[model samples]
Target: MLRFLDAGESHGRGLCAVLEGLPANFPVNIENINKELERRQKGYGRGGRMKIEKDSVEIISGLSEGKTTGAPMTLLIQNRDYENWRLKSQEETFVSIPRPGHADLTGEYKYATGNLRNSIERSSARETAIRTAVGAVCKEVLKELGVTIRSKVQTLYGLNDTFCDLFDDGLYDLIEKSPMRVLRHQEEFMALVDSAKKNGDSLGGWVYASCEGVMKGLGSFMHYDRRLDGILSGALMSIQGVKQVSIGNPFYIATGAMYHDGITYEDGKIVRTSNHAGGIEGGISNGEQLEVYCYMKPIPSLLLKLPSIDLKTRKNSDSRYERSDVTAVVPLSIVVEHVLAFELLKEILNTFSRDNKEELLAAIEVRKIRIGEIYEKTTDY
Candidate 1:
């Protein structure tokens, strides 16, 4: 039942979020949320905007003395760049040309607005800043439940540097030390980002996230919406520039018996030898690390514009140029991690059906004490 929504523009006054359904007595941390916001703006190939914005959250409601009040929580992130655009709102600004890869034209048509500024303002990935803020809170809640989440950039450009083990528990600290959040370092990746920046182009890459300490039976197979993988994939797909999602291997590199995991009984407990299914089976979590992989397409904003049609003149022209990153894969990995955190937090709450923080904690303790009960229900591999 945990749900939240974000509002505000890319360069608007500020970004805001209203989150509801959190139980009373759950401690809130503004500093942790700020730290997560800081991570979202860090990367190897970020733009000038990162330098301009220092995001911090102000809890407007539903928090009293650093604890939740079981009411709707409101968060505000003031836009540092809003001062430049504040005066321009009074005048009708029109972007004659629509960018090819952005929602410029489609959003205009859908919203019945002629100015593409309206589309670009809200459609910009900058809004994900607040979403990351929301996820930071969820991450804290998950931490209390003994669940941890993290993400890594698997590869940049055309490199297939899958050096780290997908389900490694010890990689989180190392990945945090990385500028790009990946295990392996390649000079070629850095060079590509620099070259792309100088040449007015952009690059994209793959990111993977893993969740540890999730108990079994968090999702249901009865309904499509209730399925864990479906919900996770949907949340991941909503990220900007993300083109595809994979639970395990997207190409299914395995053949024959290698495609599935082998289950065995060990010391009176059920154990999974391998996790080819990425921890979820039969639309529910199976008490293993839940892994999600995503492929992000290159950012559309480039100094070198592609061919586009002018909305006003009805003539072909180069797309509008904007200051943008050469590659967002680094900070994007953090975004993916936080999004995954929110999804897991919601699923845990919904599955546990707890109405308060004490109840939720007790329920988690119950699951931990009875982990073998779920495993005993299904003995087959």
Candidate 2:
């Protein structure tokens, strides 16, 4: 029953989010939440806005002494750039020419607003800041239940040069330092980013996310609506500009080999040897690390202008340029992690049906015992 809603415009005073249904006595980490926000603001090709805003979250309610109070949690992220936008004249207002590939014109039409400024303001990527905050909270909840979510950029604009030895200790470090969050061929990827920026264009990329320590059978195959994969995909696709989703491999290789993870037994425990199904099969988690990959389209608001029709005049015109990132895949990856964390938390809560951290952990322990008993009696793979 966990849910959240975010409100505010890109250049408004700030963004606000309200999260409800989180259990009481769950530990709240303000610093870690702030760090996630900071991560979302990083990445190569970011524009002047990143330079102006130092994002921080203010917890206004539902937290007391670093623990949830079982009430709705309200968060605030101030827009430091609001001062610069505050004094603009109504006549010298922002552009009315909606950029192609952006939500500007459609939002204006849907909201019945003649001015496109209102459309772009709310549809901006800036709203992801609040979502990051809410995801951070969900991360805290999952952490309490021994679940961890991490993400890294897989490729940048089809450049796969950032690959380090996947097993090397330096892989994590390299990913953390990378502006594109790529771990493979650093120099080549950097070159591509530089070239894109020089041309006033943008780049797209992919991200790989892994979740460890999630227990099996957290979702039910009995009903399609209750499926974990459906929930995860829906949550991920909600992010703007996400073009594709992959559970594990982007392409299915096996023709008639089931293409699904089969159950097995190991050390008197039910498990699977290979996770071709990406830790899920039959719409449920199978006690394996959940792997998800997302493809992000390049930022739509390009620095170089494009063609568009003026909303008022209905005449073709050059689209107006706005300060925007040349690439947002890196930050988008972090945002993806936050959203996935939220979905995982929802699934866990739905399966365990606990009201607090202690109760949830106890319920999980009991389920583990039940699975262990079943494992001992089953001999077939």
Candidate 3:
């Protein structure tokens, strides 16, 4: 079974991750992993920290000559910002009074610790940096198998643009170019972000992700746990601030019949006229592109402070301010992409059922042939 564990605190020296269960002889690229980390740090409405830190990963073990050795992969990302906090002594303790919406305050309570620092530190978004590094490694594996995952922001706050034509001619290019990493509609989006900052508030938005070249039958309908959609949803919801997830369109239209993708047959091939089900049905891939969307709630760390009780004094007081983004939905989108990529890669490995890279490819080719044969022989009853 493929599994991974991450370690490090928010203000610690760095984050570390260990990923095990990958097959041997898969190509690894350190530069690509660093690039993914860079992408996660980019994006508008980010806080001052992005300017201070340039994230990069160093492979400690389980790889040599740019290929995996079929052993546990260990990675490290040094925190350049750790110097800022190292001056404080252990005796000089600071208490947290403000609780973020999706953080581990409740967990701290269960442990009965006055110092919530450890709880919030481990629960921080800093952990996702390691996750992105691991996902970048998975992307390398997927690329070798002809599969790719990509994502983009779909909505900011209440403003949305679904009309593909209305999007900037250079929308995707702008996403690549802009620090905020948002697509077209930048002027408008930035205006809103500026407005939010002026109001001492924050906002959240939606992200759309897609995967291409994933084979059919990666998951099983016979068991609920084996459902691909369930796995994907769980992975995405794990990200902080991600409150809602959907495979496809979540809106209701005037006509009920218009909602679902209609099935069609052509030249001995089964196909859906539309992808309203997001390339999945009955917990399995349907030989179409996989689509997913995640909705992020606004970050709970507001510049306009709210009332709270100091953890040490147990007295009423205003919340403490930490360095946080006005809108983390942008970076959260990238984090969602990585989490989904990791889970999807696991599903791919499960489907192929091979520990070696070449063996997995051979199995996938055979499976594709079998799918073609099944489609050719089956007819509508």
* Local distance difference test scores for all models: 0.85, 0.84, 0.82
In terms of lDDT, model 2 sits at 0.84
Q: Which RMSD values do the candidates have, in order?
A: 2.3, 2.1, 2.4
Query: Candidate 3 lDDT, tens digit per residue, 1-381?
Result: 677998998889999999998889999999999989999998889999898999999999999899998999999999888998889886554565746574546756777566777777888888899999999999899889898777777788987745231123465565657555555677788888899989988899888877888788878898999999998998898887789999866653536477677777788788777777877888998878888889999888787877777766778887666778989877886887789778988998887778889898999999989878887777533
- As for candidate 2, its clashing pairs are 161-184, 161-185, 162-183, 162-184, 162-185, 163-184, 163-185
User: Which regions in candidate 3 have their CA more than 4 angstroms from the true location?
Assistant: 90-93, 100-104, 163-171, 252-256, 379-381
Q: Order the numbered candidates by lDDT, best leading.
A: 1, 2, 3
Please report the TM-score between candidate 1 and the true structure.
0.94
Instruction: Give each model's clash number.
Output: 0, 7, 3
- Write the residue-wise lDDT of candidate 1 on 125-212 in tens digits: 9989999988988887787788887788887888765556645657666777767676666466778888988898999889877788
Q: Give the clashing residue pairs of candidate 3, or none.
A: 43-179, 43-180, 44-180
The TM-score between candidate 2 and the true structure equals 0.94
| TM-score per candidate, chains pooled | 0.94, 0.94, 0.94
lDDT of 3 at 299: 83
